[model samples]
Target chain A: MPDAPLISVRELSKQFRTFKRREGVWGAIQNLVKRDYRTVQAVDRVTFEIQRGDMVGYIGPNGAGKSTTIKMLTGILVPTGGEIHSNGYVPWKQRRQYVKTIGVVFGQRTQLWWDIAVIESFKLLRKIYDVPQRDYDERMELFNAVLKLNDYLHTPVRKLSLGERMRCDLAAALLHNPPILFLDEPTIGLDVVAKDHIRQFLKEINQRYRTTVLLTTHDLDDIEELCKRIMIIDHGRLLYDGPLALLKQKLLRTKQVKFVVKDSEQAARIAVLEKDGRKIEAVDHLTYRIVFDRAEVSTAELLRQILAEVEVRDLLIEDEPIEEIVKRIYAGEALKEVSA
Target chain B: MGPGVRKHVELLVAYAVQFIKVRLAYRADFLISTGASMLATAFAFGFLVVLFQKVPQLAGWKFEEVLFLYGFSLIPFGLFNVVSLNLYNFGNDFIIEGKFDRVLLRPVASLYQVIFEVFRIESLHEVVVGLLGVWLAASRLKLAWGPLEFVLLFFFALCGAVIYVAIFLMLTCVSFWVEDRVGVHPPVWNLIAFGRYPLSIYSGFVQFLLSWIIPFGFATYYPSVRLLGRPEFRVYAWLVPVVAATFLTMAIALWNRGVREYSSTGS
Candidate 1:
């Protein structure tokens, strides 16, 4: 009905069995005779669908199976159970053919050869993907215009700065013009300026080409700036999946409202308005800060009550920061699980 | 040729061109490494000559026959070194360092991509010296060559190269499970070094080990002996292609299993 949503993953799961060894010499010798292994559920029945042209962020804490899920989607790792159908192809089963339809960039690793020039690496990828000469030239031109790659096109990849290498990598991945792109921490170690450049390029490609992008990153700024839909996974389980705005609204409801009153008498009267669940603190003799849950007390109603009580000179209302919201979400989930 | 095969060949050639360019950029290192390989081959040949001077024949084989076998062994070894040398780095660079994920992400078979990614042009010196050694021995021995013998020589060399590659692939695939253990190349190289001499000189077990266990003999000794018109070992010579195909299949199977077992390191 809705173009079948470009990527469909149904209850995909991955489990790993890792050997456990002891610390000392005796334990090492004992390990040879009788080995012990523990099974870890790295990704457990994670399910989500991504529509065409949607930029979705996949996020989690360390060892939360974010990379494992990305690897499965990119056909690098076979899922231990369940199914994944991206563009009508089962990723791991039809790996070689499926990979031709997608591009992947793991931030910590460069797909290009270390000693080769950026252009040489792109040419090699062209041959590898069998992209026609005309298409290759067109893509290179477009990438040069958008990514400003002409500056370091002839420089070897090893000599390029991190930001330059990442830009070239993004161009190389897209040279084949794949309809889907998977970026795992694509801006992991980049500075603020470089991160902005990569995010802008990704947003453009996703919009212009209708490319389905599934990005996994730790930097909240990356998620805030690029992703519209956010999926949070923890302990191999998907905890939240929906619009980023909705997630903020659901987990974060408190807003801070600061009022600058004309006199100390007005401030004292406003501080008395904190009788309900709202909290009021005296910043100085002239200013009063009120922290209230927007869901419980509407900002308009609070303003009305304040005006009815005393005359206010200036007032400012601010929503909770995304960083604080995300921290609370993680901490809340973690604490509840421990207590349970 | 099918379009798929043609594309793969083109990709391989493209990769080779880049690799050559990279090697050329470090001209001094390239020359030194190539010269070192040539000098090592000469030293091995010089040792054989000195040993032959002290004795008319060793292990029921003449000096010329042994020299031919030695040279014949290098052909496949050199080709393997040039084409599949990265197999030796599977444990360290690919597995332990988690670089194998890049190979899997490509739109080609991982084995095919890894095999053709880098061509060590410096190793070509081994092939040249090997061919020279074989020709010198053949001329000195006054061996007669018919068209069929020439065809057989080429066929055996190809089969020998396949066997060598198969063995290399199998050993390197061990990294998929072991993670990092310095790889199996060093011991495999030592075993291959034995093939430069007549298997007849070794004990019964050593000969069996070379002939069947690891099949180093099929790569060099049996092929060389058959080319020299020796009928006694001709029975084993017929098994060359059969053994090569079997080992190659096993190697691929092992590699796939290793890929499955690969618990990729790092986030």
Candidate 2:
């Protein structure tokens, strides 16, 4: 039982049937009797598992079913087909009891009462989740220390700044000390400083309490900084699921190397070698940049070729940026490379 | 009581206290709304007085008897107002706007949280006004307050409130499918306008609709008739409890289905 995954999902799918409205008056009138409904497959057979202490990032483009998957996992929306067992409880069926074992935060919305003070909302959460007084106090202290909620804890939620409110929301979700945490864009629209604070707090909690976190975020830095593994979903299908490094390595076929040469003559000599998806550009009189497909040519061979032909002073090698890799994945280009 | 029930009760009390504090913070708004509600109730009473001046009786019912019926109807209406006006917003605020996500995130039942989240303290004026109208009508009609009558009145008011709650709950459930902000509750809600007067005033079909179909009449008319020592409606008066239980069961079943069909908006 201990070796079993803490959160397991098997072939989960959700299809939403929306009424397709028509254009003109005739179509509208016809819709009243024999309506037309179009079904959208929001989540298609998404399957993954998370260990008790693992922080996993669930990322996708807009309308890519990240929120739908998170919603199903959190028991807010039922899955049309498939199985989800978080802590051995079927989320939708055993909602009232299952929800007690997990905490969820939707970044776009605050669970806290708008008109009440931030502390009051926390207090309400404490009662709703039935947190022990001693435990509540301890968690509040820790959250205050890490999240820096002291300044706006007494202010009404509507009056707090976005960063302050997001911090309070994170604290509220944790007060119950749920073993599993589901966050959908928890750091959305936050400044860099606030985003760092939230990411730090998330990391600390995941390590200290062994809280299993399933985070869905558009912020790539959140994934880069916190998640060791990530699942990429798009068009309702799980595109890629593996270690973050492996995903980066798998999706990126090209590497860039910038070198400082002796003169424009060395740069011109290197520019002639541009072939087969490899392009060389001159920066100035003594510097040149070479982009080569890693599959066709290794970094060492390229370096050797450059060193053998030209007088190379200094060089730096860099992998493709994660943003571009993610963009390619979302646009359905990475699927071909990933499968191959 | 069990721990689970006790926890819910404690939470309800906490929400009520917090809501009162929030209401108190906006004293001017509270005072204006409360005064407006009082004036509305008085206007209703004033209409009744003017009508009695025009006609000695309505459909063989005296002004005092009709007043008692109107007052009795308010008991359930007030109860529904306090707890369930929020249900009217389920489609727009919770479903379309995705605020229901917060409710489902909690460990409590969704309905329980929604009902208590925004307790309408201001609507308690309806119950106070109802009590005043009942007291005034009872004095004018010289209605005796026997133990059976008092107990019957309590059940009538309680069951009557349950009926309205059930009806509104079913109406609110329509939002789960329709996905519209403006609910299908208003037209049905206006049906309550007929329940305060005697069913005899309406045509036979409307009476049948009130008695059997929608059943708001059982909440006010049948119970009032039976309380006034009218033997004809005694059987219908006892059926009030039965009607309430049946409708509530249907409403809860519908609500459960609605929850299952809940497809949350894209975030």
Candidate 3:
């Protein structure tokens, strides 16, 4: 049991039935007597397991069932089908006991009292979660050291800036030392510096306390910077769940290397020296760009051959942008689903 | 009590303390609102005074008796206002705006959290107003005052408050099934006005509706009658506790059903 996954979900699904309304006042009147309803499958048979110490990024477009999945896992929304077992309890059934082991933060909403000082909210939360006084003091010291919350600890939540409030909110969630942390866009609507500060705090908590963090974010940098494993969900279905490096490699096989040469004739010579799924193109007479599968031809070998043939002035190597692959996923282009 | 119950009680007290602290932050706003409510209570008492001038008694009940009933009713009504008035906004603020998600996320009972999150200290003035009315009426009527009578009066007040809370709690649970923000509470809440005067003043059907259906009679009129030593209403007076318990049980059942609905549909 100790080796069991901290969170396990099997064939989970949620369907919402909404009253469909027609356009204009006439439709509103007709809707009183007779109603039209539509059912939307918000989450469909998503199956995944999260280990105790893993920081996993859950990414999807808006309304792509990311929140729905998170809600089910957090025991906020009961699934219409399937079963979920987290921390040895069925999430929705034993919600009170299950929630004791998990902490959640929604970026757009605050759990703090708006008019109270930040420290008072923390004190109240300490009592609500029944955290030991010694643990509370220790966590406060740690959060203050890492998050620098002492700067705005006495400020009312309404008076604090977005970054300051977010820091306090993060500290509030960790006051109980919950084993699992669920963050819904925890760094949304913040400047680069603020976002980096939160990411650093999250990384510190995950490493220092071994807290399992499941983060859902629209910000791809959150995934690239924090997550070793990323899950791609689109239109209620989970398309991919595996290592980030494997996803980048499997979806876009070719790595592009740009070379700017002193001689113009070498550009033409390089374009025709293509074989397999490798090709070289001339941006102009003096520059050549080589596109080759990294698995088939290593970047160092390709660069060595090109350098030996021509006196290269400058060169740049770039992997396929994750944005390109994500956009393709959003556009309904199918990639063979990857499971971890 | 068991440790589990003690822990929840401690949490409830903590929630109440935080709520009162927040309310006290706006001292001027609290004073103005409390003053306004007291003024409204004064107007209600004034209307009764003006009515007594036109008629010596209402439906064979003297002005002193009616005043006592009105005062007694406010004791429980005020208690309900102080504790559970937020139930009136359960649908609009909690459900429609999706704030209930926060309530459910915590490691406590959702209903307990909802009940204590806000305290209407401003409405405490209504209970003061009720005490003043009772004092003034008892002096005028020269009623026999004893330890048993005072204890029974206190007991009735507690029962009245529970009944009112149960009634509103049941109405509030309707929001879980029907997503309307306005909900079905207002019309039912306005019906508390019937219990202010003597039930004899209303027709037979209104009397039945108040006695058996909503049971506002057990909260106010019957208790007032028993306090006055009316042999006719003696049986009804003892039924107050039973009525209160039955309604509270039903309200809690409805609340559990509503919570189940909320978890399943997430509305």
DockQ-based CAPRI category assigned to the predicted complex of candidate 3: medium
- Among the numbered candidates, top DockQ falls to 3
TM-scores of the models, in the order given: 0.90, 0.90, 0.90
Q: What is the lDDT of residue A285 in candidate 2?
A: 75
**Candidate 3, which segments miss by more than 4 Å at Cα?**
A22-33, A253-316, A337-340
Task: Give candidate 1's chain B TM-score.
Answer: 0.95
Clashing pairs in 2: none
Clash count per candidate: 0, 0, 0
Positional deviation of A111 in candidate 3, in angstroms?
2.0
- DockQ of candidate model 3: 0.60
List-wise, what DockQ does each model earn? 0.48, 0.54, 0.60
**DockQ rank, highest first?**
3, 2, 1
What lDDT tens digits, residue by residue, belong to model 3 across residues A4-40?
A: 8989999999999878766666975676667778899
1 versus 3: better lDDT goes to: 3
Q: Please state the error at residue B76 of candidate 2 in Å.
A: 1.8
Kindly list the per-residue Cα lDDT of model 2 for residues B1-267, writing each as its tens digit. Answer: 499899999999999899889988999999998899889888988999999999999999989888988988888788878888678988888888878788887888788888788877888888888877888888898987789988887788889989998988988888777656556888989999799899999999999999898999988899889887765677898799999999999998998777777734332
Instruction: Name model 1 segments beyond 4 Å from true.
Output: A23-32, A256-317, A333-340, B263-267
